[model samples]
Target: MTTLPSSTRRKLGLVIDLDTCVGCHACVVSCKGWNTENYGAPLSDQDPYGAEPSGTFLNRVHSYEVQPDDGTAQLVHFPKSCLHCDNAPCVTVCPTGASYKRQEDGIVLVNEDTCIGCGLCAWACPYGAREMDAAAKVMKKCTLCVDRIYNENLPEVDRVPACVRTCPSNARHFGDLADPDSDVSQLVAARGGMDLMPEQGTAPVNKYLPPRLKDRLDRTEEIDVLAPFLAPVTDQPKGFLGWLDKALDKI
Candidate 1:
């Protein structure tokens, strides 16, 4: 039903830079602002004015404290969202065909119009990336901002997703994962990056590169373990020697 070329397969994906990321919430805010307005459904809060308030988010930054057995502590902030995997389980589990991946750019998109309000997609996801749209009564997830990225009117740099554009630390990246020579691909190759929950065999196209940490011994606290023996000043006369011993004790 489409007229695009067969070789026009878009290898749509995200490349998050762990080196430059400062764990700022700028990307989170930018994603919420853009997707909630232009996308198919807006992320809404159930009881915004009530005691408990929660909203659907396509992107969330999670901060974790990692401690080594050698009494070393480290802070790790990980931002979680849909990986748009090559073997995406969310698409296969959808009974109504609402959840589908774009053949054009390899982006996972949800068709709210065809969705039957079933939460099957959410359960199938291992990353907890999908969230239900309370207002639309359907499952909602990241679209990679297809509407904005492909628009010819916007500048080339701004053509990327909102999250990538608004990142203060420039942590988020947008590019084609299939391209071995792409910026994202080159960065991953050089940085020794890693993926999240790789054990699930999802083969997620989106990769997570953990922040490099300093060595443990660099911060180890040093203290003198052995005490030096000192001569007994008790037998000395009650003069300069006694006073010196008292001063040493005070020292």
Candidate 2:
């Protein structure tokens, strides 16, 4: 079985803002497109246009209606992918050492060449991040777009993960978690970013910012702050509108 490194040089991961994710799936589409073209074996699909279509995807968005004690029911869009955990069970459970964690950047990856299409990694992963590519017959998961991140040919701005780049709402972030001064780390500190299932003890690198509750609209006792703006300028037509109204009335 494989073993994890004692420590990694950097904890590179994502910081997802639950408040801003719009559930548009742009990240999912971009991930599929980029990985298929540049990364390892193509992500396969069976009957893509048919009724029962299924395919391998590294990123996915799941929406759920949640009700908080202090707020009304709200729809939350959650994007899930490989967390690249510090204590990655998938890496340690791999019999052939096909799955391993990088000591350089702390990215968990599967060695497809040495991978015997074994589903051990999938079983060991608590997040259900791994998916089987039907055509390639190999287990696949998110690689944090490792190829794009370190490429010198690409512009510095485009070095982030495809999900972070394509997020229309600017909900996704990528940076070194090991650096206390990184923007991602600062955002996490400001927003109180939390881990996914801390009870699992996987120590996932990715963090999620909790959605801030919307202002209550149903309460009648409290004064509405936008009352002035909500009030009309005048019930009767006035200014340019008054002139237009008089002309229309004459007609």
Candidate 3:
């Protein structure tokens, strides 16, 4: 069995906003595209375009219709990935020491060369973040784009996780959670971010911003109904009215 570090210097993780996410699946597609080539192993798709199509992915977006106490139903888009817990059970259950957490940045990663595909790590993960690649027979999960984020050849602005870079709604943020002054940490504090399933005791580093409450419109006042037909004009005016008449004629 593997053991985690006593503590990490910097707990790097993601902060996802449930309110701004549009369920676009852009993060999913971009993650698949980048990680398949750059990371530890290639994410494989089995029988793509066939009757049953499935593939390995690091991030996924799930949508839910949630009805609040105010009586308005809202569609919440939740994007999930590895939380890189401080006391990760996935690391403790790995028989081959393949799964381990980095003490520097606190990113959990698997040693593909040492992994025997025993599936223990996947079984131990409560978040269902791990997946078994059928083709390579190795366990895979999100590395937070370790290759990209640390690559000096890439531009500083492009050093974030692929999902964060490609999010059209800017719902994903990455930074060191250990630093209270970091942008991600400040955002979490400002939005009242919360960890998922805190009772599980994974001590997940990632935080989720809850959906903002929508302002309920007052319905006590009666609405005035518009007339079904417009009143006939006595005579068509010139100049601006002539242009309006021409546009109405086309309509």
Q: Candidate 2: TM-score?
A: 0.88
Model 2: CA > 4 A from native: 220-223, 226-251
- Quantify all predictions' global Cα lDDT against the true fold: 0.80, 0.92, 0.92
- Rank order (by TM-score, best first): 2, 3, 1
Candidate 2: the clashing residue pairs are: none
Clashing residue pairs in candidate 1 (N, C-alpha, C atoms within 3 angstroms): none
* Residue-level lDDT tens digits of model 2 in 1-251: 37999999999999999999999999999999999888788998899999999999999999999987875889999999999999998899888888889999999988888888879889988999999888888889999999999988999999989999999999999999989999999999999999998998899999999998577778743667787778887788889999999999999
Q: Each model's TM-score, in the order given?
A: 0.82, 0.88, 0.86
Q: Over the full model, what C-alpha lDDT does candidate 3 score relative to the true structure? A: 0.92
**Superposition-based RMSD of candidate 1 using all C-alpha atoms, in angstroms:** 6.8
Question: What lDDT, from 0 to 1, does candidate 1 have?
Answer: 0.80
lDDT of 1 by residue, 172-204 (tens): 888998888898888778777677788887778
Give me the displacement of residue 75 in model 2, in angstroms: 0.3
For model 3, how does the per-residue alpha-carbon lDDT over 111-174 read when each residue is reduced to its tens digit?
9999999999899889999999989999999999999899999999999999999999999999
Instruction: Give lDDT: candidate 1, residue 4.
Output: 17
* Candidate 2, residue 119: lDDT: 91
